[model samples]
Target: MADWISRDDRLPVPVTAYGPLHLLARHVHRLSDTGQAHEAITAADAYLVIARIVRDEKSVRFLIQGKMYALLALGRVNEAYPLAIALLHSQRAAGSVLGEAKALCDLARIHLLGGHYVDCMRNLARAGVLLGTAPAETDRHRSALCSFATAATAAELYEAAAGAYEQLRHSTSSFDLVHAVTLLYWGLRLAHVGRSEEARSRLRRSAEITRAWLETDPDPTITAMHALALAKLGETTVAEKLARSVIMELRAGGSHQYARMAHLALGISLRAHGFPQEARREFIAARDLTEEGSRPDERPIIRFELALTALDLDSGQASRDLFETVEGQVRELWRLRLQRLAMLRQARQREETEAARARAEREILRDPLTGLGNRRRFDLLIGAVSPAREAPLTLLLIDLDHFKAVNDIHSHSVGDLALREVAAILRAHCRQGDEAVRYAGDEFVIFLGGDAEAGSEVGERIRMAVAEADILTDLHMTVSVGVATWSSGMTGEQLFQAADSRLYAAKWSGRNTTAA
Candidate 1:
């Protein structure tokens, strides 16, 4: 263990100060994203030390979450569980329901690994209740939902798990590792329900996605799952070979938790190849690995498989006892399944209601024609700005040149198209924290963090872009832009008036130009 920890000398140095916490956190996330779990842990540990010293609760929570992810990635579920419990307590003390929900989901992940299906479902149910009022699109919400789906799979809520995975799959990019894992787990669920063909397709797609970027050094955990998928698909020879290699890698890397699954994969393939005796050994080995405080969530499945092999070996009474034990476990799982179903129904209703409310709110704050923020959103932004501004803020006011003429000549439809195009251009130019708004007909506003000089440069680019737009080629469309930097103690109205004056000047000087 010490050797493995010391091997990653190339890990990024932890941030020395609180200000660089964001950078350090990003570094940890990037390493995690690239499947560098050991490096991620080292980086996160460094960040965690600084975060604790600064007493920055947010940073501490984030660092803990990052470390938990890295530990789970390395199949160190035992190490992650206490962190998750601590996080849950912290979140509860902070009075943050959403954060608490996410923490519970993290706990569910631990329970899922340990073959604690009832506990997993119980945690997920509690998380669902906490998330009742949270925004559906938030990262915390999405991550919690993913945990729910995984737990649902283990708890035998096949339909619910499938639906949740499908929803998440549609929302995530194909290149995302989360998306690949979602597909992989969804495939495993499908296989559990005897949808072998669909399971194979999903597993294949997941493998392809991982292979796309992970060609150099693939994740052993995913490779092990892929091997299991292959075994389920009856590719016994290839599956056996791949599973053996994955088991060796996982064990050597000290990822004994995932190594158990690798053993299960090997067992499956060996059984498929008619070596029931050898397969039983692999199954028992997998079960034995659950000792020493390891999560035994997988033991149920392993025991079931061992019982099958026992029957094949003509150990009738031993197999029967194993089956009876498994049946008792199944009965408990079924009870949890019923509770989970009720929770899922209630959660789904809440989500749908909240989604509806959110949609209505967005529609109110958004411009229908341009798809930009409406005047209402502009008001909200301006109202939030303090008189003693902390940073330079520049506003750009723009008006389409001769937009009325375009409507008169080409009809109102063409005018609308031009507006949408301009809106898209504005959206493209604005930075992540900037705002672009459709103020009114033929008028738009951009709020950015910079001085007048920077604002003028952006205004000039927008003016040029609008003038050269191919969609407006025949119409000869152009725009006049005015840039105004907010002065200390200036009200939103004063800022607007200043930009308006500059915009009038740009129009007077000749349209399609910028004035600062």
Candidate 2:
């Protein structure tokens, strides 16, 4: 902590005797945003102490949120949880829907950092629902929702994110940095789901807006996002220059995480421009910069991009595995298979004993707890079902909403039974061609031959079936579903990601809803 928290360095002193409180508070905010969490915490705490002493609820609200945010950034979850609960209580007591929304968003953010995606989405959904039902949503409420939506996007809930950004874009009169960031996210999400042309258009608009806004508001984040968007829009040279500038600025500021992101963005631009080796180098640096304390949601995308760049690094096994992920491109895949066929030898094959052992090993793919296939089996199925080759393949990624809370409140035994019941419902409703897999604890996936509409119908049926099941004595299960059908230009991984994003959208729309 900094000396800003000394007894003599109180907010009252700053406001009345020492310096301007507004300037001090702004400085505190800048500290928090620029990754100086410990310093920000001290300043925020000092302000909070003075605000409470003076009974300034408004100042208290702002200062407390800043304090919690700093605590969150520092990975001090155990401390942040109780404070979050207290904030929610105070917000409700004050009859401020906006404040309550902020509290919920903070809790959701904590859950997100803890890798409790289901819990995060549930809290986020509740907050959105609460603010949405309010009789009058002023600019403040809209702004709060926009922030919530930004969190949703971070959680990979694209539909809710787009809706939130759209609302904020239309509602807010000011075209500032936040607006620029929102448009960038909206465009990025659009690209994630295979709307490349429209996404490019949006990205171009985002870049234009950001370029103009940069004259007054210079931020590395805006610069990085604009560069990535330009890369996506095929202006790789321009994107590289912009991303490099961002990396330089971020590195100078000690913003390692953003610097890492900038590295990855530049790698993407380099790769698009046919510089795979350069891209691999950039990706390597990006991966090296990641710390254990970095946000959980960022890890997956970072690793995914790193693997994509690894292909050009002459990495054999990993590259082969990654190449299989290029689903739906039949001719190329067949060519690769043919290239490997010459290496196969049948006469030196295993005997019946070895064949039986192999079969037994494959049989272990079923999840023992829920009687569904495990993640390995899910991966195998996705590998076989190419999205680019067959547009009919649909993926439905499902998450049991608030399952962690159930485990915490009831018992793990009850949670297991609830999972079993949910699995049974899924098994009962899945069509003949569908395969249900328990991807992870409280998370499941379904791969089927169907269109998006059929996938949605099946997802809804699964939801209804689980809601109707009562095998667990004290447990109830509700699931959120994200559906994605294979489309041209989409890889298997991208298809799965699309479904995952929809799952969050479902969770955001009040869990148990299906988003396709």
| Top candidate (lDDT) | 1
Stretches > 4 Å off in candidate 2: 1-31, 43-50, 133-139, 171-205, 211-223, 244-246, 255-262, 292-298, 313-318, 322-516
lDDT of 2 at 494: 85
Estimated TM-score per prediction? 0.55, 0.50
Give per-residue CA lDDT, model 2, range 222-338, as digits (tens).
777677767767778888998888897787777776677578679888888778898988877776777534543345445556666667666698686874464223324334333
lDDT of 2: 0.72
How many angstroms is residue 252 displaced in model 2 relative to the true structure, after the best TM-score fit?
A: 2.2
In Å, residue 51's CA in model 2 sits off its true spot by 4.0
For residue 391, model 1's alpha carbon misses the true position, in angstroms, by: 4.7
lDDT of 1 by residue, 443-475 (tens): 999999888888988999998888878765576
Please report the TM-score between candidate 1 and the true structure: 0.55
Clashes of each: 3, 2
- Candidate 1 runs further than 4 Å off: 1-40, 43-67, 73-287, 292-296, 300-330, 388-391
